[model samples]
Target: MLEVAVIVLAVFSVLLAAACGWLILSQRHLAALQAERDAVRDQRLKELSKRLDTYLTGSVRMGEELYELRRVVAPLPDKLTQIEQRDPSSLSFTQAARLAGMGASVDDLTQSCGLSKAEAELVSKLHHAQHPTS
Candidate 1:
């Protein structure tokens, strides 16, 4: 009986040691996998930062071009007014309306074309008074 008890105790000790060794190996593998994942994440973040910098540089260049165009065309409105003053009779009704600042004018012949209903009514009244149907 004593010999049987000693053999059983030895078998239990061997199983406990094997279980501890397997647990330690599994923990080491898990740590290695986590380290590799962190490295990949850092590399992706650097690439995204570079791409954003490029887009911001392009946006600034486009804004400068737009400002330059606006400066170039700054004198156009005055030049157009001078030409109209020199030859007012040759200007169309819509052009006259815009110059007079009256929302409705005689030259707007097309119905519902750009002008609102009130504008059209004003234009109709002016047309009738200038050339009565009777």
Candidate 2:
């Protein structure tokens, strides 16, 4: 009866050791899982921050471009009124000369600046001769 008791005691001790080892291994696994979660969270935060910065920079650039466009367009109405009310015939020769320098076609010169067909053709030829393309 004493030997049987000793055998049972030994078996119990072995079972306890196995349970302790399992517990230790489970704790280690849990720690590793927590560390992995932390790393993933950090990476996601960095990526989101970078994306937000890029978005802000683009928005600022777009706002600046809008401001510049407004500045350029602010005087367009006044200039249009002046052009509409001016005597076209008075400035026809000068306007034709400038348009020819800017690569205007003969038809455009004749229509916009009231040049005759022959005069427009002469201006186109002279301007083209001055700034010839290869």
Candidate 3:
């Protein structure tokens, strides 16, 4: 009876040791998988940052070009007034008529030829009557 009890205890000990070993191996595998996932995520984040930096650089260049364009166009309104003042009624109406034929808005004619909005609209209407579009 004592020998039988000793044998049972030994078998139980062997099974307990095997279970501990399996648990240790599973924990190590889980840790390795988590580490790999973290590395992949870090790589993707770096790639996205690079793309954002490139887009920001392009936006800066476009902003600079727009600033230069504004500088170039700053004196245009004054120059236009000077020319219209020198030429008087004939040149402005001719210009307005041409612009009206080309689909200029009333505001465009008012700004470009110094005409009132009513006059610009009248010219636009006359031009449209002379040449109807399809």
Winning candidate number (TM-score): 3
TM-score of every candidate relative to the true structure = 0.53, 0.57, 0.64
Give lDDT tens digits, candidate 3, residues 55-131.
99999999999798667556544544564566675687678878987789989999998887866776666566557
Instruction: Judging by TM-score, tell me the better candidate of 2 and 3.
Output: 3
- Candidate 1 TM-score versus the reference: 0.53
Range of the 10 consecutive residues with the lowest summed lDDT in candidate 1? 103-112
List of clashing residue pairs for candidate 3: none
Which candidate gets the maximum lDDT versus the true structure?
3
Span of 10 residues, lowest total lDDT, candidate 3: 75-84
Q: Which residue pairs overlap in candidate 1's backbone?
A: 93-107
**Tens digit of per-residue lDDT, candidate 2, span 11-42:** 99999999999999999999999999999999
Per-residue lDDT tens digits for candidate 1, residues 29-68, read 9999999999999999999999999999999999998788
- Candidates in descending lDDT order: 3, 2, 1
Alpha carbon lDDT of each predicted model: 0.60, 0.77, 0.79
